[model samples]
Target: MAGVILPRFYGCYNCRKRVALHDDIVNKDFVAGYRKRAYLFSHVMNVEAGNKTDRRLLSGVHMVADVHCGDCGVVLGWRYEKVYQEAQKYKESKTVLAKYKIVKLDYW
Candidate 1:
């Protein structure tokens, strides 16, 4: 599936609401020199409620694809993070969006 292009969508895990695909806040790079744009979605574990004592926590963002289904308008899945080395290469190259393909849609 190196050359295959998958569809994308932005789906809310809470209400299962989906919206049209949108631009991602950051760019990602995949294996074999593939690249795509993606956004961050905070997961339940990532969120921390305030406690009695003053304390801060480090939470990671759950990345999701910025896509929306055209027919039904449901978000497919959260975006996955790409390899660090590959992503760095893409960031340095500064290429066009057409250079890479949308490989997966993590629906479910």
Candidate 2:
């Protein structure tokens, strides 16, 4: 019961279509001493990444690809794959959204 995760519905801001669920994002176990990456808890959808493209996080770590709106092709955020230093093997995909670019409707 300690590790069970619940699903959350999030949509692409531009498309307004369901893209991803909460469980798709990864969270790691607590580790001490080493620097930890920034954690953002939000609804994410329609993200893309590539080996050729590069994005940087606040921690100065390079992310593999830019997260874009799948339907509208808007730059929504970035994806930090295995090379993110904090997380490995695309276990943790990261993204950031500008306030004006994203909105969450709480129907719950």
Candidate 3:
């Protein structure tokens, strides 16, 4: 019998809720707060965005919202709501998840 292959996913660290697919990762060299590693995903699931606020980041000022795990309410990262700099406009509407805050799942 042929074994079935499953797609890999990234889950919340607090709870094993599936959040983002490994295939959906857009940028893997992203850096989160405090110089921590992160990844920018094209899409995400099982997460809730908090209130939008303007903050100065390494890039520049951006309007972002903190994203939390829908199940355990843990802060995973932030979603880019708006980008002021024209060169950084590509980040808008994308989600950034801290590498330490997520775990790889479905790997055989």
Candidate 4:
């Protein structure tokens, strides 16, 4: 027999609903040198403008595994490419995408 550990909840900012965390696709070695780090970068749109909304744009996709709260479905930190690139100019640094907030649904 095999046992699996999974997240219990996922909060969606768009709909403001807390959904179950299923359909997980884990990439163990998404980032190099950062053994525990993973990347989840998907295109998303900014729909806050009502009509004439901007199209989906490229979001940087790099995250550390330690910042996620499986029980509450919150992400403490994340790193995006734009921020990463900027940080790279100075040195190798990871940008803090979000700090202790519900992981936005569109972020995936």
The 10-residue segment of model 1 with minimum total lDDT is: 43-52
Query: lDDT for every model?
Result: 0.30, 0.48, 0.94, 0.31
For residue 49, model 2's alpha carbon misses the true position, in angstroms, by 3.1
lDDT of 1 by residue, 1-108 (tens): 798655454443333333323344243332221233333322211112221221111122222232333334333323233213443333321211211222222562
The per-residue C-alpha lDDT of model 4 at residue 48 equals 15
Off by over 4 Å in 1: 23-105
The most accurate candidate by lDDT is 3
Model 2 residue 94 CA deviation (Å) reads 4.6
Better of 2 and 4 by TM-score: 2
**C-alpha TM-scores of all predictions:** 0.21, 0.49, 0.92, 0.21
Ten-residue stretch with the least lDDT total in model 4: 43-52
Tens-place lDDT per residue, model 3, 3-108, is 9657799999988899999989999998998989999998999999999999898888999999999999999999999999999998999999999999998652
Q: Compared to the true structure, candidate 1 yields what TM-score?
A: 0.21
The regions of model 4 sitting more than 4 angstroms off are 1-29, 32-34, 44-73, 76-81, 84-108
C-alpha positional error of residue 73 in candidate 2 after TM-score superposition, expressed in Å:
1.0
Q: 1-108, model 4: which lDDT tens digit per residue?
A: 359544444343334344323233222234323333433323112111111212222334322232233344444333332233453332112322221233334422
